[model samples]
Target chain A: MTTAGQAPGQAQANLIAIPRDWAYDFLLFTHRNPKPCPVLDVLDAGETVSALKQDADVRTHAPRYRIWENGELKAEPENATDYWRDDLVTFLIGCSFTFETALTNAGVPLRHVDQGKNVSMYVTDIQCRPAGRLHGPMVVSMRWIPESLVDMAHKVTALMPSVHGAPVGAGDPRMLGIEDIDAPDFGDAVEHEPGDVPVFWACGVTPQAVLMKSRPPFAITHAPGQMFVTDMPDFAYRVG
Target chain B: MTTAGQAPGQAQANLIAIPRDWAYDFLLFTHRNPKPCPVLDVLDAGETVSALKQDADVRTHAPRYRIWENGELKAEPENATDYWRDDLVTFLIGCSFTFETALTNAGVPLRHVDQGKNVSMYVTDIQCRPAGRLHGPMVVSMRWIPESLVDMAHKVTALMPSVHGAPVGAGDPRMLGIEDIDAPDFGDAVEHEPGDVPVFWACGVTPQAVLMKSRPPFAITHAPGQMFVTDMPDFAYRVG
Candidate 1:
């Protein structure tokens, strides 16, 4: 059994804590590298009110925090007590951990994880439907599937809707309106060998881009890689 | 085929328009009665620019409009040109009419249509999740189903999510927090036979009740029964 009070570093990293405004940038950075920074929880401003989990204090839960101002990196803080507000709304969107587990269980080889590099992400010209003040093109994470099991790969991942769902566009990346797949919008570019169709799924970084574009007066999100572990079982979000 | 030049009477009766300050009440009413008053659209007070449908001139689209002043049905007019403002945000919600066709097509007997009376509705203890200024108990429409096929009835109606989408409660009226099934909160109640179960679907009149409770300074909704005719096909909203 993995206890919440195991390693001090892992415990503090997983705990919820109220982060300073500077923590926003750190979280955004983590969101950029979704494979490593899969978000599990977000605390609105003020006293880290626990919405999805119990005893999950946002002030001192996570070990570290980063802040961003006007899309620029600002500072990193152990906790975010000074940069809290009353109007902030927290969103506990799905993380990629669930999908990674599915892929690994299904015997799909992951290149980025194996090479110790960030998963490839790119900004597609295809626009996401804007919600309220949030508007931007979609940022997709790519995975290369071998020719033999591409169909099975799609079928397996398509079951999880909340965790980014099935690939938005498969086959050629150019069809998704990307001019140069080599120069991705964020993250490192990975080599795609023959017989591997680059699969893309809407990344959790979508909300970050939305947050950046909307520029809400005040907001708080999970620092990437630091996630609030929940009792919510992953299978609950899956569909047949 | 329903001709376009039908004087917009039935469609106009579906329009719910109010002054700028009453926006909150309008949203409330939508939450309360989700069936009959299914919010077809909202034209924010000052942003009179219609985007969802053409010929929906907020000021003069409906053949007739009702102005509610402090819960009182005060004035009837053809246009709200004098009450235009810039702060309003229009919302196009789903309507029950979108699903009624499906129910009839599936051989579900609609008593109100057969008797030429308004579908019966009542306020229940079921409270809708509050969003911003809108908050209130849910109102539901009652229907009768034969004893043998009640399960099939639920399966048939559950398919239409945009419309009311299945009964919230079945069998007993008292269980719905409704007393004296004949005395409906709004609309006239119909007779239910010995072998019939009183099935209820979320009512569209919810927004009105919510709007009245929230009491935004200005708001507007379609007068009951009248609706905006949309260009999109109803099947477009159905999910398989």
Candidate 2:
């Protein structure tokens, strides 16, 4: 189900599954870290049907699934049937792709998308408000918006708080303990043109980073950039 | 610490305490219902000091507390020292007072406050997104804002997503299944002036309603309108 060569906008063709018993903990994790782990939908244990998508199967619909055990990547299976359990609960998290669309609609250009590069992400000194055993520095995705459009970008993204909301910081990476703007902890960095300002929004990679650091005994998450697409329209997330 | 006779905007001069073992579940409940249960501060198990306030004591700070067992209100105590346990976790939820301050700063008048009546609240047909065993209809607080100030009210309140971002509905109460504006499931109803629009915000009472319906084995929350006062300023909740 992998769509590796797909167009720039089409990613997130997968789902992540975790043991049902840990479902509440994971939900708490996302709630405590709204910007990085905005929950789009959730499926109860033993339920294959998605509340966000009709005819969607949690096991087979996702083009890919990454299984992590004790903080180690054990498998990237095409389908999770072999690991599917009645007690496994599924969660669909909001992806930045939705906000990127909103930004584009508001006339903000995405340099990374234009250059066909992954948006640059960095591990910052900012500590996420912890929930249970999940605690780690917030991961943020940086974009270069024209100085004039920075406020517009902020408003556009702020309308959708569920998807990381507005940028956590703008102008200075050093303030966030990011020593180098050219180097990122994850993804490819794009160049900033003249008159552009460096802006950062909470990255969805945060949960994955916390999982890697905290090393929960068992967990599952969609591979980076591969999310579970929902039937809900982008505008559905926008608020007044 | 009770401020019962204080003027409007000076309430929330108290704190509530409960058993520490149920702290995580209670935190999960607040996270799932942020609007009604905005967590202003949380104390670790066995800790009585709140990170949000200096010289604050959870045991004797709150003027009053309502204890619930098996979903029934069992006690209203002036001090919870008798019930305090090492594992009891305490959370301070965000109150409408924060958003009302924002609205006032933006030149929007709160009718309930001016009329010296409690904000009208109703149990809607809309179901709150469930977390664990907690699930119930969303409860909303309604205030009448002049038609001209509705947009300003929205922009002001939307800045505080932690407290209940924007009005879920503005003009017609019937859209939210609220049949009579004069009749509220909770709180006193305030009169609407000519050209006033009834605006609804997700209420903090929602989590309480959910707890009552779901009937968690044990739980504790501030009595309505009697919230935990945090040293944090109201503007802290406002976003760009």
Candidate 3:
């Protein structure tokens, strides 16, 4: 179940849980690659509740979960309470969906949402700065914006740097080394309107890509588009 | 000597080198309390070179260094190359002086610089948000700004949150638990102009205050105002 356009003005976050032993490396990783993984909240070991959302419980809040063992997906559970461990450190990363409200409010059309599909996401050739044992290629979410509205979308989202801000690449799909625009590594393929150009923004899934490469003993994360709806307004992180 | 008004437009940073073992906790500490500790760069263990500056060495670049042994000042040396350790992870924090160049360009009168003194800093009753084993009261740098331009000062610095952004408090020292304005916790007191008001901004000297309380086994930081000058312009960190 995608949380796309789920809670209106409220923010949504991608959640990742890892063992306490590997938490430091993960924290350092996010700091080094902030654009793709802007940390919204970090819950210390055994802390079930999120600092960003007081009412949410990490163990059971998200609608779906992906449980991983040594970087291999072992199960897709509805609630992670059964797999929850005392030594897990949870990180809530800012999701691009959190800014959809502002885009919609500003009159920037979202083609994927109109067609009832997930936004397109892909693994890029971009190498993220390494931190300790965590390092991997950056993952980015793609949106097809009209040539006229591209600058407006960029300026609006640039104001909120805490979320994935500004386009990493706005024009060519080949520049980031993605061979085919039709085939995405994650999320759905969407139909584009006339005069639309592909725009890429750094994605929260970059950490999951890192986890796959690093191969921590165990990990858990929200399933695709199954974000934790936060209480913060979209403008809550508006720094400008 | 202070880097104040030195290298007019280039960025200057506060250097803090701590052992690799405690780097995680310190990294988390800065993330939790970002207003005072905006991390510009975190060099891995034994990294004497800064990513922000190509021609600088962390061990010998800063004009002065403070060697801390379990929170006690062991020495104030001219260079830290002698005290450099293979296990040290250096953090370059955003110094407020970085924005002073912009403030000066904006015609904001900085009384401390006018009087040839270090900006006055104070330890406030305001406790910083804690993370792991690191927690302490916030330290603030005060400047006397003309009441008319207070809003302009706020807008200019707010654009650069990486540095201590905007004023924490613009008036009434009593609100921040600063007793006796004439006597400051750090730096020399400055005289205010006719229409000036006491304005406090989050300070780079904050981590030094935290070091006294948390008491890590070993640490190294730049001496007062002896910032390691970087090649990047102040606008490099400007998001808006």
User: How close is every model to the real structure, measured as TM-score?
Assistant: 0.68, 0.83, 0.97
DockQ of each: 0.09, 0.30, 0.65
Q: Which ten residues in a row have the lowest lDDT in candidate 1 chain A?
A: A2-11
Using alpha carbons, what is the TM-score of model 1?
A: 0.68
**Local distance difference test values of all predictions, in order:** 0.56, 0.71, 0.88
Q: After superposition, how far is residue B148 of candidate 3 from its true place, in Å?
A: 1.4
Clash totals, every prediction: 72, 9, 0
Error of model 1, residue B219, in angstroms: 1.6
- Every model: Cα RMSD to truth: 7.6, 3.9, 1.4
Error of 3 at A135 (Å): 1.2
Docking band of candidate 3: medium
- Expressed as tens digits, the lDDT of each residue in A120-202 for candidate 1 is 77777666554334456667877777777677667776666446656777878898887776777655676766787788877
Q: Candidates sorted by DockQ, descending order?
A: 3, 2, 1
Candidate 2 lDDT, A51-153, residue by residue in tens: 6677777776655667778778888776767877787777777666677776777799988878777678899999988866768888888999999999999
lDDT score, candidate 3: 0.88
Q: Is candidate 2 or candidate 3 better by TM-score?
A: 3
Residues A1-240, model 3: lDDT tens digits: 778768888888989999999998898888888899888888889999987789879878888999988888899998999999999999999989988888998899988889888889999999999888788899999999999999989987877778888889998899998999999998899899889999999999888788788888999998867888888888887775
